[model samples]
Target: MAGSVSPRFARWLAFAGWALVGAGYAFGVLSLMSIGVFVLAGSVVLTLLVRRAWGRGGIAGLVSGLGLPVLYVAYLNRGGPGWVCTTSGPAMSCTDAWNPWPWLAVGVAFVAGGIALQLRRPAAAG
Candidate 1:
């Protein structure tokens, strides 16, 4: 396994996969519980892909993990400075969800955790 690819790289990929999926849940695009299930499922799939295809798992994980958050952010901000509520009861304002500082902090935490795990080599050995 380590003959063709570095274990450190593999771990980084796995961590990236987990992070991507985690961010999606964190931002509410995907429910928190759903993300938990995705992590378990993604682990098995990524393990198999890493074992057989070398860098494919990492690439996929990177794409999905990183892509989802970007997409979600774009979607959320599409209307610009306002909250689009799907539920009816009381009207929700942009202030309810458009706080830049807190969201930025949350994003930093998610990306930082991913990078830290990658640096720590958590996904080594397929």
Candidate 2:
């Protein structure tokens, strides 16, 4: 089926989505993150609506689209050991932290889903 969403446009959308996501994390801005997610989701939906939704281009677009949320959560739960200490003229303070297993698990799930999408059979073109 003919579509307004060209492969080049879809690719650009994916690139923009990832860029916004990365910038959001770098700047710690929720608004950027939210917009990035919506853009990425839109790219995937548009890809699916056009001809050959399961084709190589579409599959690549979908996998990259999924990366948007994956990047979001990755930043949210940047799992790593954490600790803080402060001292000022005999005054001291310390805080302990632990790794975010749950969030990391969610990231893994997103990755797996993307991989599965990549392996999907392409639909026969009309």
Candidate 3:
């Protein structure tokens, strides 16, 4: 399967993962942004690891790019909050939105994905 995947595809996946993270951050969803950054960074590391092991990098990128969104949605469903400017803002209570599970989940996912990619077997040579 590794031999069947193209390096270019992997690079694109990595690029997409980073792009999602940047977009999430730019939107001011701090938790999501943090998740994105973590995932993006992990994707980069995975790319490097894969490159070194298989003479290419990107499987992690692809997995991350596809997985982050799913995880993000899951986190949201589990009560992820929207960005709030201040505790004083109407309809924005810090206590209600301050749950740490989302962040933890994202971090764990990023780390797990990175570790998995790093440990994966090298792609078979053509």
Candidate 4:
């Protein structure tokens, strides 16, 4: 996929991901979450960069971007996002988000699929 897709585009994506990672790490560390959303996005971008650099399975790049976070969040929550629809009281209303495991699973699937698709095809086939 390297020649198939413009190298400029791939390099740009890689640069964007790495750049975001740097910025997010700088400011995001101060937040309560210990990490910022930008950093996560950056990780995904990095993965995409690797995929792009390898020259194949462009879709996997996006899929990995989605999967990495899903897996991370799932790991943090220890399975899912925890209890949803939390009714605290009039003072405050809190609700948990959906489980990341499902999304993570889907991401893993896509990543694997992308890898499989990008496998070196026989030159004879061409």
Best by TM-score: 1
Clashes of each: 2, 0, 1, 2
Candidate 4, residue 93: Cα displacement in angstroms equals 17
Error of 4 at 52 (Å): 10
- By TM-score: ranked, best first: 1, 4, 2, 3
Give the TM-score comparing model 2 with the true structure, all chains together: 0.35
lDDT of each: 0.50, 0.47, 0.49, 0.46
RMSD of 4: 10.8
**In the order shown, what is each candidate's alpha-carbon RMSD?**
8.1, 8.6, 11.0, 10.8
lDDT of 4 by residue, 12-69 (tens): 4543343333333333433428556666566557556654554332433343343444
Error of 1 at 120 (Å): 3.8
lDDT tens string, model 1, 33-83? 556566556555655654464444344344335444644565565454555
Lowest summed lDDT across 10 adjacent residues in model 2 is found at 21-30
Better of 1 and 3 by lDDT: 1
Candidate with best lDDT: 1
Query: How high is the lDDT of residue 84 in model 4?
Result: 50
For model 1, the superposed segments whose C-alpha errors exceed 4 Å read: 27-71, 78-97, 121-126
**Model 1 TM:** 0.42
For model 3, residues 15-98, the per-residue Cα lDDT tens digits are: 455434433333334445456566556556654654555343334444344445545555654553544344554565542344
Per-residue lDDT over 2-99 for candidate 2, one digit per residue giving the tens place of the 0 to 100 score: 36777556544444444333333332333454575665455445544442432334343344444455556555545434775668999997655345
Evaluation by TM-score, superior candidate among 2 and 3: 2
